[model samples]
Target: MSTVLAAVGAVHPLAAATVNDNTPWVGPGMMGFLIVVVIGLVTWFLGKSMTKQLRKLDAGRAEQQEAEGEEEAEAAAPAPAHDPKLNGAH
Candidate 1:
């Protein structure tokens, strides 16, 4: 099995050479950290912009509903008649 693996490595230049048991794998370095930070900032700004747009849409819908309600109320009610006798104005 080991010989077969060694032969495979010899045949492929891109294959891993030898496994290191000395040090354990660690986290990303400065470049990777900066990339992650940039991605997070971009995501945060996009989310904020989306929230603002949603709030605007909600406000517009609320105003439209209020206007529709006023129209309905006006259509349902009848105008009152004026009486000068009740007002004591001969």
Candidate 2:
């Protein structure tokens, strides 16, 4: 059994080093910075797009309101003519 174990250990010597090696790993601060940067970029792009859409919607609404106002003014009935002599006739 000892000879068999020695033979296996000799065949794969770096396996033990790979498991025991403690190389410098990433810290929480770096991870947090990456996450914040990604989120901020996404928010900036989304805000720009949302503002553009809102402005377009406002412009369309304004145009529609102006057209409706013109239609209403055109459809309105004209006021009757006033006569100064009719005021004393009553």
For each candidate in turn, the TM-score is: 0.61, 0.53
Q: Which ten residues in a row have the lowest lDDT in candidate 2?
A: 13-22
Off by over 4 Å in 2: 1-27, 77-90
Q: What does candidate 1 score on TM?
A: 0.61
After the best TM-score superposition of candidate 2, give how far the Cα of residue 23 lies from its true spot, in angstroms. Answer: 15
Candidate 2 accuracy as TM-score:
0.53
Residue-level lDDT of model 2, residues 1-90, one tens digit each, is: 556656656789875555455897657787899999999999999999999999999999999999999989988968779987889764
Error of 1 at 13 (Å): 5.9
Candidate 2 versus truth, CA RMSD in Å, comes to 9.2
Q: Model 1 lDDT vs. the true structure?
A: 0.85
